[model samples]
Target: MVTKSDTNSVQVEIVPSRFLMPETAQRLLCEIYKNGGIRRIMIHGPNMPREVPYGPGKGIPIEANRNLLVEIGDQAIELRVKVGRIRLEMESEDYLGGLKAACERALPFSFQFRQGKFFHDRMTTSDYAKYGKVEDERILGLIDPKAKKDKLAILSEDMVTFKEDEER
Candidate 1:
């Protein structure tokens, strides 16, 4: 996990007026990262599955056209949802102006930015049982502190994958 002091971190919530397309989201993410000072970013929206979950085609792979290939710096990331709200954590409050400017430039639709704590701030029962009491409050949230990385994801070129018949 990416360990850093979140005590002074500032959360900026971006809610778009409408569901964002894959290309739009990718563009916006790139813009935000380019502006710098971002510690973590969480994209939230309606779940989009790779396969049909129920009915006669329950086991079949979904032919979705909205999947995105987002590039952050040199890393390629896959975005699986029709982005609705984006929550970002910055190192400090000083980066707010740049972030807001980036958002305005990248997002064509109207958006709202609010500052507050959107992520978990304390350890839960599951965290204590799995990792025990941790001194760092930054590692106390829903994400696994010992995990490989905290917020970023490296994705392959192909954005979609099909499930085997038996696995479904």
Candidate 2:
């Protein structure tokens, strides 16, 4: 029963107050380097600060990442966040397939899951993170949540991580 307008439903996190304008993300880029190598990068100018109090449906573009889309609407800007990153952690490309199923289980959705499929042994790490499962902060849980939070490393970076593979 989802409609086009419903598809526009998005999560909003207002900064609560102030906005942080890093002079440049170059410092963050430099910290990632394991090797002492200096490289060149083409960085665009800083974004103009949107002094408007941030509330729901308010955001200015910062940098591009996976699943990011910028579209100009007749009245307001239409920013589309594709479901790409959401599926990446589950090793699944089927966005609506798995997530919708999770939503059905965790929240209010009219659907039923089939046997042997609702729980994936292959993705046990995210099995609990999927549906009807909440992580207890009391327990030191989750091996690597940060890994899933980030997109693939951009080769455009000035440096790279040199790991020693077993074969080496």
Candidate 3:
């Protein structure tokens, strides 16, 4: 179980000047994942609907053909949003410099990086009603309670990709 002390982890947010495409988002995410101190990550942006939501064309499939999959250390993450901003918690402030560098390498345009309390430190009523006293605090606000599909994906630093890179 996560305690109050553990919830005090350093939180950082990265907001790009514009909404990122899947390819750019994928590159940025892979770099962030490579740096390896991310305890939790949340991406925010406008949702891309799979079908028309209103009008006579409602319920019909949209013609938008976009690759929503991004590979990070052998893990393929599905992109549900346009990736305008990214909020994450780190183990410590020591990793901030490397994170900034990673963002610079991936993002060609300007971006903003700030530090503050962005995530919930404690569980909410909805969370309790849905998950019933979750033991893992890292994912407290990572997903929606009503959503049927689980959006949370866990990636380890000890994955084969990382191990292979270390051997070189």
Give TM per candidate. Answer: 0.73, 0.14, 0.81
Total colliding residue pairs, candidate 2: 0
Candidate 1 on 25-139: residue-level lDDT in tens? 8888889888877666667777676788799889688767334566667765556667898887788889999999998999987899999878687777866776677664543
Model 3: CA > 4 A from native: 1-8, 145-168
Q: Per-residue lDDT for 106-164 in model 2, tens only?
A: 32223232211211123345534642243332111222323332211222223232212
In model 1, where do residues sit more than 4 Å from their true spots? 1-6, 65-67, 129-168
RMSD each, Å: 7.9, 21.3, 6.6
List the candidates ranked by TM-score, beginning with the highest: 3, 1, 2
Candidate 3 lDDT over 15-119, as tens digits, reads: 999899888998999999889887777778887776888999998875462456778777665566678999988878888999999999999999999998787
| Residue pairs that clash (backbone atoms under 3 angstroms), model 3 | none
lDDT of each prediction vs. the true structure? Answer: 0.68, 0.24, 0.74
Number of clashing pairs per prediction, in order: 0, 0, 0
lDDT of 1 at 1: 100
**In model 2, where is the ten-residue run with the lowest total lDDT?**
11-20
How would the candidate models be sorted by lDDT, starting from the highest? 3, 1, 2
